[model samples]
Every structure is written in C-alpha cells, then in structure tokens.
Target chain A: MKKHNYSAGPCILPQEVFEKSAQAILDFNNSGLSILEISHRSKDFVAVMDEARALVLELLNLEGKGYEVLFLGGGASLEFLMVPYNLMKVNGKAAYLDTGTWASGAIKEAKHFGETVVVASSKPENYNHIPKGYTIPSDADYFHCTSNNTIFGTQMKSFPETNIPLVCDMSSDIFSRVLDFSKFDLIYAGAQKNMGPAGATLVVVKTEILGKTGRTIPSMLDYQQHVSKESMYNTPPVFPVYASLLTLQWLKKLGGIAAIEKINDAKANLLYSEIDRNPLFKGTVAKEDRSNMNVTFLLNDEAHQEKFDSMWKAAGISGLAGHRSVGGYRASMYNALPLESVQVLVDVMQELEKNS
Target chain B: MKKHNYSAGPCILPQEVFEKSAQAILDFNNSGLSILEISHRSKDFVAVMDEARALVLELLNLEGKGYEVLFLGGGASLEFLMVPYNLMKVNGKAAYLDTGTWASGAIKEAKHFGETVVVASSKPENYNHIPKGYTIPSDADYFHCTSNNTIFGTQMKSFPETNIPLVCDMSSDIFSRVLDFSKFDLIYAGAQKNMGPAGATLVVVKTEILGKTGRTIPSMLDYQQHVSKESMYNTPPVFPVYASLLTLQWLKKLGGIAAIEKINDAKANLLYSEIDRNPLFKGTVAKEDRSNMNVTFLLNDEAHQEKFDSMWKAAGISGLAGHRSVGGYRASMYNALPLESVQVLVDVMQELEKNS
Candidate 1:
C-alpha cells in the first residue's frame, strides 16, 4: 500500500510544496546562496513576504479590508496569550468558548492578562461537541473560540453572529476551507497544519481592533509591534515562510479555497460514511459537530483494536492512531491529505468488515 | 571562483552539512515522509533530539556538569528576557557588559524584569571593543555578555571571572573554539549562526540556578518551564532541531570542537595577518579585541570601496558587506567558512594591493 501521513501536525504537505521547497533550499531564486542563506531583507525574500501576506488576504478574499497579515516566531500557543494581550484592555474580561485542549490552553493564557469568562464549556462530556446556547457578552473585549478542535475532533461549524469581535484559534483548519473572515476580528494558525512547518504562526487581524490594550507587551509577543514593523522587526523563520508561500501557491493553483473545500468535504464524507456504515467503527465526536480536518473514531470491540492497528501499520498508513489524550484512531484530513489516502483508509475498513 | 557566504545568519553551513541536510529533506531516514513532516514527539524525532542534545554535550566536552542543554523555539533574543526571569533575583540588579547591538538588546530586555546596570558600554566608540574595568556588582544577580560581537567584529578573548553568574550570547562564534565553559553560568546562541538555522536557540544553563525569581513569568518565557519539560512543554521546532542534529553530527565527524577549533584559529590568523600586512586594507578593531569569527576592515582609500566591492562580487563572495549601521567590509568567518574561501578573499586583497 502507498504510504499515507495522518500525523496531526508537522503533519503533511502537498508533494509539490516539498519538491519546490527542496529545489529552492539548494539555490533560491537562482542566487548563488541557497534559499537557506538569503537574507530576509533581500529583494527576493521581501517579494516572498509581500506575496505571502497578499496571498493570505487574497485566499480569505479580504483584499479590500484593513487586515494586517503577520507571520510571527512562536506558534499559536503564543497567540493563545497574544490575542487577549492585544485585545483586552486593563482588567477587561473576554468571553471564551472552551471546546478542548487548545481552547483551554488559550483560556489559561488569556487569564494571565485579564478576566476570562468561559461562556460555554464541553468539559462535562470531554469536549465531544462545541458548546452551544451560552450568551456571548457584547461588553467583553471579544468572543474567543477554537474553530476546529484538533484533539477531540469537534468543530464550531456555525460561529455566533455577534457584533462582538470573534477571535479564533484556527491552528489546525485555517486554510482548509473558505472562511467568512468578515465575521471575525482575528484568526491565527500554527503553520504545521495545512500551511507548513512549526516555527511560524500566521495571524490575520483587523488593524482597527489593535492598540486598544493597556498592557506593556514584549515586542515578540505584541501584535501591534509586528504590524508597525511589517513583520520584519526581527529575523523570521525564513524556510517555513517560504514553504507556507509555496503551499499557498499550490492552493491557488488548485483553484483556491472553494475548490479545495469541495475536495476536502468529499474526503471527509467518504471516511465518515465508512464509519457510519461499518459495524465495528463509531466516531467519537457528536455527528453534527464532527471535524472534517480530524476524523476520530473507536472500535466497537476493544479486542479488535490491536488487529486494526497492526493491519493499518502493515499497510503503510501512519499517524492514524489517535492522540493518547483521547485514544482510539484519528486520521487528520488536512488540505494536503490526498483523497486517495482516505480511499486506502476506507478500503481497509471495508476489508476488516468483510473479514469479520 | 568558489562562492563565500558571510551572512550574519541563515548563514553559511559546511558543504557537508548542506549535502547531508538536502538529502535528509528529500528522503528522511527512508521514512517516505519528509523530515519536515515528522512530529517532534515521534520516536524517530525524539531520537533526533536526544542525539542532538547528547552531541552538544559530547562536542563541548561539557557532559556531567552543572550545565543543561536546551533547544528552544525563540531565538537568543527570547533568552535575553528568559535569563533574568530565571536567575535575576538579587536586589533587582542585573549587570550587563554592553558589547554590541545584541548584548545591548539583552540589557534592554532585562530591564523589564529588574534593575539593569550597564556596567560597561562600548557604544560611544561604535562598539569597537568590549569595555573593561567596570566593576560587576557583587549583589547583582548575573552579569551578561555577548561572547563575540557579530556587528562590530570584537570578541572578549577572555571571559570575566565573575562572582555573579556570567551569561553570554555565543551566537556567532559557537563551535569555533574550545572553551572553559565552567566559567559561564549561562550561554545562549541562536542556531542560525554556527549550528544550523535561524529558528532554534541553543541554551546552555546551569540547572541549579533557576526558579529563584519571585516574579511570575509567562510559562513560554520562563527557562525553568523549558528545563522541567525538556524543551517539549509544547511542540518544538522539529525541522530546525533535526537539521541542527545533522550539523552537530557533521561537526563530530569533523572531529568535534577541539579539531574544528584548530582550523578556526588558522583561518582567523591567516585573514587577520593579511589585514595587518596588506597596504590596500586597514583592520578596524583594536588588535587585542578583533573577533576571530568576523574580520572587519576598511579600504585604505575611500575611493577604493567600489573597486573592492566589485572585486569580491566578481569572485562570488556574498554578504561580505558589513551591516549598514557599520559600513565597510565584514567577512564573517564562522566555522563553516572554508579556509579556501578566506584564501580567495586574501588573494583578492593582495591582488588589489599589487594593482595599487
């Protein structure tokens, strides 16, 4: 069987992204220096920065808006604190939706800066679904949510339509589908998922919402400082930025988000359908709130777990085992995951069913 | 002519490091997925981290000591703040030897946490030397210094024996010499310099000297947090760490720090001797302070600047240009800079002198 990667992150990349990236590493822009050596301030690299930032706005189709695209050093975990630090005024309370591990991590970081109101939480059920029916406070600095819960395989399919700024930790599923970006003030993603490697976090923020926080933030942690310096305040993770750029180019070539969204939906549908139709498999997240990015499931009988694992490993499908924090199986279907890989996985489920 | 790279960083790597890294990126340990795709938490990658950490101690001959090696996300700039956060607890005073832009940046970052005393500063003379004779405050928690100044091309040939903890930013000149590391309580280097790439920081800290700071620090910004977790409180930068591991293996194969230090000494001596002997060029820093890592010089005649630049460019030497803030020529002679490249540059200088 062909090798497939389902490793939640530092996960997967389109084969083309890898090919083009490897070529550039040896010799970037045909310059004598490898892409590895070129200065971020050099014209070739500056053009890369421009194109990357432009593509981010373009991909979201927010070309006319005042959103500043920032590629920063620390990953989304940094943004977990940064979002509140940048948006929360002195003693300001922010409303947070506690969906899973990452969302709670973000809430923990936010509490360091100001009061955090956990408007809704799914902890009682171990975060099987995005919490609903909790009123969002307009007076709170912003309403924070995790667009997709990577660990628990839950997604906030419908965001609350409120005037309050909707801030999201969209680390795992940012570029996987078309986002109604106008509905949110800030959206940040760690590049490891759907974008590139782990060094850079891509932040899309409205310029108007910044500079209101009263905290004296460190330059590295401050979003406004990055904006004023145009993300050139310091040496960036150059290769990852270039890889993200290449992946975006791949996305653009593959007909942008709308086209890719259909393909992703089809891939997720195939696997979810297989789980629904099969007697031995059952998804962990509630059916309505299941994530297309991370499709998690469990065996009907625990005795078959080892058998399924061995068969899948032998067939060359990797990263299919679920996070130990939430065990069973999780096949992360990020944008780079090919439909064929899912087909292989689906075929394995069918094979197991037939054997049984 | 062979190409030479003197970039401050994402700088030169030995041809061997590049060859090995390029191959690994294309087909990592025959794992089918790129090394970039593997999670840092994976067994394969955990081995990469283990070997890299072990190699650091092995090459430095710093094993079984007070030092603890850490590969972290933020560059040495992050360590600027982190150092004081962990160790600066005595009377709110942290003394700094302001050697250059980077060392001064550290002092600035430290001020946020405690009272920072610039015990000595070389700035008025454009950071041409490490200042001397300013007393280290016995009551100060730690005295910080940059081992080798990257911009102005000066080095502290002998570290100050301090009653207080000695913190050094060894970014540009690490792996270029055999050091009595026992003198340093903390040494940090951004890996873009001598190690591998720009995203990771190699921090060597005395483990016993932490957690005394009464102030609360953001978990991400605290050194104790990283030490306790072994640099995996969250996902670390996997690719850079692995690439650094490969580079360290290459360093070990080149016969570790002792063997490489001999070559480094020869390379620095040859270039500095030519600078002293040549009629067309004049060395900038005082003889006692000139850095072995970066050789800074100016043309004897200001009009010879363009000719000198054209000559180097024609010979394919890149990033030989000094930082704009400090103009003239700065040939950064990191360990990866082959002696032949330096010879070519020396020959070019001689040829220019002959023409003059």
Candidate 2:
C-alpha cells in the first residue's frame, strides 16, 4: 500500500532529501566517514552548515539584509526560554498573544524572565481562530506571537504592525508560504514540521535589536554570541542541520516559497471542500482562519467515527488522528506533502458519505 | 585503503552501529517512515529511548540505584550553564577543579549563578597534567571535576571523596572504563567521543540530589523537571538518541564498559609505546595523567614534519593533527577504534622513523 503520512512533526520531507541525507549518513561527501561520525568543524560538514544557513536567507529573500541566521539545538521549546532570556529586559514587559499550546508555553517562559502581558487570546474559543483587533502596548519591550497553531489548525493571516520589536515563532508554517520577512525583529522555527527533522532550531535575528536587554544572558542562550560565532558557538546538531540543508535546497529548486504556497492552498481547499460538501463531515476551524498546512475536521455522527478511521487506515493513511484535546482528525500537509495525498483523504471522505 | 578516523568528535563508532543507524534513518523498524520523519512519541522511537536509558544504567551497574538518565540536545557546552542553573543555589558556593578548557568553561558559567571557588588548577603548567595535593572545600555545596580533557590529553586518575555533592563531566571517556557510579551525584557526557554523535548529552543524576538549589531554573535547564518528564520535556535530538541507542547496544554486545576498557587500554598502550620509543616523536602530557582515550605527542624535529604528515595521509589516517593550543598530534583511541587502527598508527610512526 502507498503510505500517506500526516504526522504533525517530525513530519513529511521531500523524498530526495531523505535519500541524500541517508547517503550522507553512510559516507558524507565521500569522506569515507559517516556524517554521524565526522567533526562538525570538518570541511564537508562545515559546507553543509554554510549551505544550510545561506539557503535559509535565500528562501526568505532576506539576503544581505542585516539578518543573521543560526542553527541551534533544543527545538522551539528551548527557544521559548531563549527568546526572552536574550530580549526581554530585567524590569520591562513583553506582550504576547495567546492563540494555542505553543504560545501559552512561550508566555510561561517569558514571565520567568520579566513581566508578560497577554494582549489578547483565542483560548475561550478553544483556539479555533487567531485572535485579532488587539491593541499593542507601546511600553512593551517586544510583541511576541505564534504565526501558526498546529494543534488548532489556525494560522495568523496578518501580523500586527507595531513599533516594538516583533518576535514570531513560525514553527509550523515556515517555508510553507511567502511572508514579509522584514517586518519582524526576530523569527524562530523548530525544523521538525515544515523544514526537515527534529533537533535544530532556525533562528533569524536583526543584529541591532540585540544587546539592549540589560540582563546577563548565558552564552548558550545569548543571541549575540551565537551570531558572532556563526552558530558554531559549540558543536551543533550536525545531522539535522544537514537534512535541513537538503530540504532547503529542494524548496529553492522548486522555485522557493511562492511556488509551494500555491500547491499548499490547493491541498487545503480540496480537503476543506470535501468536509463541507459531504454531509458526514464538518471542518473544525473558522473558514478564514483554516491552516493551509494542517486541515482538521470531524465526523457529524459518533457512530461513523470508527468506520471512517478504519477506512482511512485501510487506505494507507497514518497520523491522521487529531490531537487528544481536539479529538477528531488532522491531516497535516507540510511543504513536501503531495496534492495526491490530500486527494486521497478527500476521496475517502466522499466514499464514506456515499456508503453510510 | 581502510580509513582510520581519529577526529576528537563527532568521532567514530562501531561499523555495525553505523550500519544499523543508517538503516534506521532510511526506514525505521519497517514502518516505511524515515527515522527523521517519525514522531518522538511513536512506539518505535520510545522503545529506542527506553532501551538507551536502560543500557546506560546497566553498563554503569546503576540499575535500580535511584539514578535517572536523560538524553538532551545542546551538547556539553549547554550543560555548562544548565548544571549551574539547576545545582548552584543563590549565595552558595561550588568548588571546581580547573583541569583544562571545558572545566574552565564550566567554572565561568557556575560563577554567574553562585560563588565558584577553583580549589586547584593545572593552568600554570599549560594544563599538561592534572593538579594534585589540593583539597576540596567541605563547606562547598558541590565539588565539580572534568574526568577527561580532550584538548590537553589529561585524565583524572582518582576522584575526591567528599561529603559535598560530586559532579563530573565525562565527555571524552564515558563508557570506555569502569568507575564507582555511587561516588558522583551527577555525571554528564556529551555524546561525541566514546559514544555516538555530537548533539545529545547523556546525563545520569541521582534523584535525591535534585530540587535543593532553591533557584528558579528554566524548564529546559531544570534537571528535576526533565526527570519528571522523562527527557521528553521537549522533542529530544531524536536522530542522535537513536544512534546512541545503537552504539550502546553495540557496547553491550561487546561486554559493556569493562570489555571496552581492555581494548581501549591496549590501543592507548600501543600508540603511546611508539611515541615514547621512536626517538623521532615524544609524548606531551605527564606519564601518570595521560588519557587512555586521547594520546598527545609531538615530533622531535620540525624538519621531518612534511614527510611524516604525507606518510600518515597516504596510510588513510585522518584527524591526527593536534589541537591548536597544544601544537602536537593527538591519537584519540575511543572504544570504537579497533586495535588494528592503533597498530596502523604505530606502523606509520615506525615507517617515519625509518625514513627519517
């Protein structure tokens, strides 16, 4: 059976990326040493690091724009702590918009460093939509938000325009679509979802925005030190960075973010349309806020749930079960997810409606 | 020519371990999903994590000994800061032995959280020998030491018997020897030298020693919280952990640390004998303090440098160049390095002597 992977993350990646990464692990750049065993400072692995950093800037179209890129270990969960450790001042406040689980995690970490005010939240609605029309406080040292919520299947369509530094966690939606990269002072993403694998976190920060936080930041969490060291402050997570480089290369070869966004939209539209047109199923999030990356839905009747799940399983679908909190289905269509997989889900939904 | 990897780390691993890890990356446990794409919570990976943790305790003979093992990202450098953040209480003091570069790094980070007293240091002699005849302060909250110095090629032959909590960084010599596991409250090793790769840090902490610091630690850096969460406090460096599991399995099959320690001793002896007897080369560190893992030596004459360098390169030897600070050759004989490779290095030295 042809497998259709919808695992949230570490999720789908281009097949070519997998093949290349596998080969590198066996014999990195023909060095006769597995990528698993070579030094990160070795010429071959250094080239992997250099190319990965360059391609990130190239894909974002932020080259030569005073934005520095870093690949660090410890995922976005660590970034939740690091962002405020290096940015939020000792006595100042940072404003956050709580949209989902990840945003709430970020807020919790930030409060440990300084005062944090939640400007707005969609938690009352179970985070079914991105919060909007919230006022940004000028006195806040920075305005932080999560650009996409993987669990709730909602994405922020527009970012808040503010004079305060803007820090966004683009973990689930990075490289899936085009975005105005210049508007934010800092952006970070864990590479598990849209990028490559689970290990390295991609951090992009404007140099000018750093060094203003008066607290003494640990070297590992200090943004300025990492930027100065070119992300070689310490031995990095080498394999994941190499895999990310391959994925970035795939994205660039496929004409970058602009080309992928069109396909992503088509995939989301096809799945959502099937849910709405078929009487058996209903889309979960609001129409305007539906995520192009993760399409979430549910059956109209409880009796059809087991039948629909088995049908998808028999059709070779995996990881479609929704988060425990949401309790339905979530088909994550990352950058490498083909339109055919989305069609397979749509076909399953149609067959279920007719048969039931 | 068969290649001999002598890079400090990410260094080398057993051939079977590499093959198994490579296959896992391509198709993990016949799941049709690349290890790179599988969720950390998946049964396959959870098994890998569980087995890896179990093997660590088993090898150390610490099973059911109240010690908790964790695999985390950010390498040993991050642990430098994390150790102090979680263990050093406000206004308390920690005693550290400054053996070499990494120990100094740990001392630097520890001072930021609490008072750090360097009870003894070998810096006066360019860190070529481990300092002795110094006393660890009984009033200190803890006594910290680095077991092996990769750059300086020094190893502590004995540990301080102190009532204070003992913490040791065993990055270079972990799993290569047998030690009294009960003597230390915490033992942390970066997985690069004698283990697997460069991302994950192996932490074994006695559960009772935690939660005494009375400082607010960021969740990512808090040892007690990580223990409660079972090291999935966040998405771990999944690939590295998987590879480490395979390596640990390889170690166990080869009879664990006691068995590897014998091979490691043989390899170090073979290499050191050549360096001492050849007359063309000389060992660097003091005899008693010489590391069984890393053997540092220097050419007697600068004039034979090119001839000896090309001779080893032609023999398929790699990473024999010493650290810049030491300005000599370092043959790191980790457990994965076979005796035949050490014989090859010795043969090359003999050939160079004959040619010179």
Candidate 3:
C-alpha cells in the first residue's frame, strides 16, 4: 500500500528529490564517494555548502542583502538562546509573541539572555488562537514571532509592523508560503518541517542586526561566529545540509515559492473544509487564524478517537494524531504534501460522517 | 571512473549505507514518512538511537561494562572542553601529551577549566613523531591522550596501563584497530572520520568516573544529560545518527571490528611498504609510532611534489595533501575506504616514481 504521511515534522519530502538524494548518499554523483565521508573543507563538500546557501538565498528571492544562510547544529531550541544573545542590544529588551509551546520555549530561553517582553500571548486561552491588539514596544531590541505554531495550529497571516527589528521563528512554515524577507531582519527554522532532516537549523539573518549585543557570549551560541566561518564554524552536519539543498532544488524546480505556496494553500484548504463539514471532526483552531501548515482538529465524541485512528492507519494515513496537549488529529500540510493525500484524508472523514 | 577518496574526514562512506541513510531521510524504512518528520519519542527513532549506541559498545566489545555510549551534538572540539570540565576538579590536575594541533587544542581548552599537566610533547620535532617517556600522574584527575593525531599521523601503539582513569580523544583512529577498551575510562570520536557524518560525536565513558568534579555544567554539555536522555537531550542530529547507524550495521555485517582491523592493517601495510621500498618516498612518523589509519609520507625529491599532486588529482584521487603543519602526503585509510582504493593509491605512487 502507498503510505501517505501526515507527520507534524520530520515530515514529507518529494520523491524525485528523495531519489536523487539517496543516490548521492550512495555514490555521490559518480564520485564513488559517500557524501558522509567528505571533509567540510574539501572542494567537493565546499561546493555543497556554497550551492545550498546560494539556493536558500535564491529560494527566498533575496539575492544580496548581506544576509547569510547557515546550516547549523542544534534545533530552534538553541536558537531561542542565540537570537537574543546576538541581536538584543545591551540592556535592551526584546518583545515576543507567545502563540504556542515553541513560542513560549523561545521566550523562556530569551529571558535568560536579556529582558524579554511578551507583547502578545494566547496563553490564557491555551494557545488555540493568536493574541491581538498587543502593543509593540518601540524600545524593544526586536519583536519576535512564531510564524506557524506547529502544536497549536495557528499562524500569523500578516506579520505585525513593528518599529523595532522583526525576528520571526518561522520554523514550522518556512518556504511553505511566499515570504516577505524585507520586513524581517531575521528568519530561522528547524529543517525537519518543510525542509529536510532535523540535524541542521536554517538561519537567515540580516548582517546589520548583528554585533549589537555587548555581552560576551560563548562561540557556539554566537550567530556572527557562524556567518563569518560560513556555517563551517565547526564541521557542519553535511548529510542534512545536502538533504536540505536537494529540497531547495526540488522546491525551485516546482516553480519557486509562489507556485508551491499555491499548492500548499490548496492542500490546507481541502483539509480545513473537510474538518468544517464533518460533525465528527471539529477544528480546534480559530477559523480566522488557522494554520495553513498543521491542521488541528478533534472529534465531537472523544471515545470515537480510537476507531478513527485505527481506520486511518489501516488506510495508510500515518502521523495524524494531534499533540497530546491538544488531543485529536493534526494533518500537517507542508510544501511536499500532495493535494491528493489531503483529499484522501477528507474522503475518510466523509465516510466516518456517513457511518455515524 | 571509480574515484579514489583519500580526503580526510567526511571523505567516503559505503555506497549501500549512504543509499539506505538517504532513503530514511525521505521516508524512514519505507514508512512513507521522512525520518526527520517523526518524533524522537517514536519507537522507530528510539530503536535507531539504541542500535547505533549498542553497535558502538559492541564494536568496542564492552557490552556488559560500566561504560555508557552517547551520541551527542557538537564535534570533538566541544568534547575537548567537555572532558576537562567534567573530569577536572578545582585544584585537580590532568596529564596531557601534546602531539599535534588537535592535542594542543585539547590542552588549551583544559586550562580554562582546571589544573593541567603536560606529560610529554612532540611539537619540538614539528609533530613528526609521537612523544614518549611520559610520566603518568597518579593523583591527577585523568591522563589524556589523542589516540591518533590526524594531521601529524602518529598513533599511540601501547596505551598507558596505569590504574588511574585513562581518557583518550580517539576522534581519528577509533574502530580502526582492535583494542581492550576497558583500559581507558573515556574514549570519544567525531563521526566525520571513521564513523559516518560530521554532526554526531560518539562518547564512550565510564559511569563510575562522573560526578567527581563539583563544577556546575550546563545540561546539554554534561555527559550525564545525554546518558539520561538517551542522547536525545536536545532534539539530536537525527540525520547524522541515522547515517552513522547505517555505517554501523555495515561494519557489523563485515564481521565486526576484528575483521575490519585485519583489513585496515593490510591497507596500512600496502601503503607503508611502498613508501619504505621506493627510493622516491619516505615515511614521516617514527617506524614504531606509524599510524595505521592515516599514513603520512613525503617524497625524497621535493621537486616531485607539484607533479605528484597533479597526477593524483588528474587520476581522480582527492584530499591526498598533508596538513599545512606537515608538508607531505597523507592517505587517510578510514573504515569506509576499500582495500582496492589503497591498491589504486599505491599504483599511482609507483607510476609517479617510474615517470620521474
């Protein structure tokens, strides 16, 4: 049976890209060398790094604004501490939007480095919706936001225009839509979602935003350290970076960001419409601010959850269970997910509705 | 053309292993999900973590010992700082043998934490030979050594048999030889060389030696944290771990470490014997301390250097240049390099000699 993946992360990848990537790992473009064995400094590996970084800049349509593309170790959890450590000015506070678990996790790490002001939070409502009408502090070092909340299934459709520099943790929805790179000084994401594997963290930071922090930070935690060394500050995670590079190539070949975003939006729409029509499934997130990446929903009767799960598994739909914190279903519709898969999921929901 | 990969670290991997690893990155075990998309808590990833760790322990032949095997982020450079921070106590000294750049790096990072004693150094001879007659300190926290100096190409043939907790940075020559691992309390290696990719670091440490140092270390930096978290402390380098696991399975299927060591010796013998018999070549490291993993040699006629380099590159051989610190030739015969590749290298050396 052909399996359709709905995993929240470590998510789906295009088959064409996957095949080429697999070949490289095996024989590495007829070099008869595994990509895993090459040194980061070698001309071959250097080309991989150079092309990957170049492709990232090309993908975002940002061609030379002094922004660096780095594939670094440690996930977004590390970035939580890093962003503030590098960009937050001396004695200055950074404002953050607390939309979900990851957003709050970022806030927690940022506070340890400098003063973090929560400009907006959905915590009182259990993070199901994005909080609005929150003041953006002009004195703040940067306003941070989680663009797509993976767990809560909410997204910032339009970013807030803050006087201060904008820093967004676009971990879950990067490259899933047409990004406005000029509005934000920096954007970073864990590659597990909408990218490649989990080892590498994709960091895109405007050079002007750096060197503001006066605090003496460790080398690994410093963003400028990575940019200067070209993300080979130490030996990089080569295989993951290669995988991501392949993904960027795949995305580019599929007609850049605009074309993919159309496909992604269509996929998300189908799933969302299904959840709305089916009484057994009630969408968990607010209608206005629902995520186009992760669609979180719950059954009208919780006891039917087991049957629903088993049926989906039997139908070869995997990783549909929502986060336990918001128990039900979450069908992640990233760039790589085919619309047909979403349709399959919708058909299953309809069958359950008819039976009920 | 079958490319002969002589590049040091990240140089080559088995084609089959790379293929398998790349497939997993797309949809692990054909489960129709990117391995990166899956939760670390999932049974699949947990099995990966366990099998990789188990193989390392099994390869080292320490199945029932007090040692704990951990796959952590940050390369051996981080481990250089970590080893002292975890093992060196306030006012407690550790003995170190400085052979080359990596050993010197370890020594410098150690000084930042606690007392350090330099037992012996080969730097006076420009790292062409391993230092000997080092008096191992008894009351010291531990005696540290780099098992094989990657650049200088010198290895410690006989480990110090002292009862004290003997620690070694085996980042270069780990698994290249069969050894009694019980002799050392801690052994670590970066996966770029003999292991798999560049992101993951393998640490085999004795459980009894920890907690003696009273210094407060960060959770991620502490070895105990990885042990307790089962190396998933901070969303580990999933792609790298999977690649490493594939390599491990390949190693086990090839009759484990013992069988590979025999082949390793044969490859080393083939290269060194040519260097010894040929009038055009000369081995740099002392005969007794010659590294079986990385063979460093130089031509007697320095004039052949440029031609030699050109010939190797033209013949599709890569990364044969010696370290900048040592101007010669280094053929790093890591585990992934087939015996045929070594034979090809020897044939090239012979051809170069004949033409000259």
Question: TM-score, each model?
Answer: 0.98, 0.99, 0.91
Name the lDDT value of residue A64 in candidate 1. Answer: 82
Q: Which candidate gets the maximum TM-score versus the true structure? A: 2
Query: What lDDT tens digits, residue by residue, belong to model 1 across residues B1-356?
Result: 23688777778877666666677667788888787787778898888888888888888778999677889876777777778878888457888899899888888788777699888898999998778777888988888888899889999888877788888899988888899887888889988878987778899888877877687666777777777887777788877787788789888998988888898889999999998898778888888998989889888798888887888888888889888878888989887888888898998898888877
> Between candidates 1 and 3, which one is better according to DockQ?
1
Clashing pairs in 1: none
Instruction: List candidate 3 segments past 4 Å from native.
Output: A88-95, A111-120, A135-143, A163-165, B22-39, B84-96, B107-120, B134-143, B161-166, B208-219, B306-316
Give the clashing residue pairs of candidate 2, or none: none
Which digits, one per residue and each the tens of the lDDT, describe model 3 over residues A257-339?
Answer: 89998998899888888888777878887899999999999899987877777778878898888898988888888888899
How big is the positional error of residue A182 in model 1, measured in Å on the Cα after superposition? 2.1
**Residue B6 displacement (Å), model 2:** 0.4
Give RMSD to native, each candidate: 1.5, 0.9, 3.0
- Candidate 3, residues B1-356: lDDT per residue as tens digits? 65788877876777777667767755677666666567776789989999999999998999899989988776777788789878988778888989898898889878877778999998988887888777888889999999898888899898876867899999888887888998989999888888888888899999899988887665556788778887887778887888788888888899988888999999999999999998899999899999988999999999998888888888788879888878788999888889988888888889988998
Go through the candidates in order and give each one's DockQ. Answer: 0.56, 0.73, 0.52
- Give lDDT: candidate 2, residue B215: 86
Per-residue lDDT of candidate 2, residues B48-79 (tens digit): 89999989999999998899999999889888
lDDT (Cα, 0-100) at A262 in candidate 2: 93
In candidate 1, which residue ranges exceed 4 Å CA deviation?
Answer: none
lDDT of 2 by residue, A1-356 (tens): 33688998889889888888888777887888888888888888888898899899989989989999999998899999998888888898899999999999999989898899999999998999998899999999999999989999999999989999999999999998899998988999999998888989999998898999888877888989899999999999988898899899999899999999999989988888888889998888998999998888888898998889999998888889899989899999999989999888888888998899
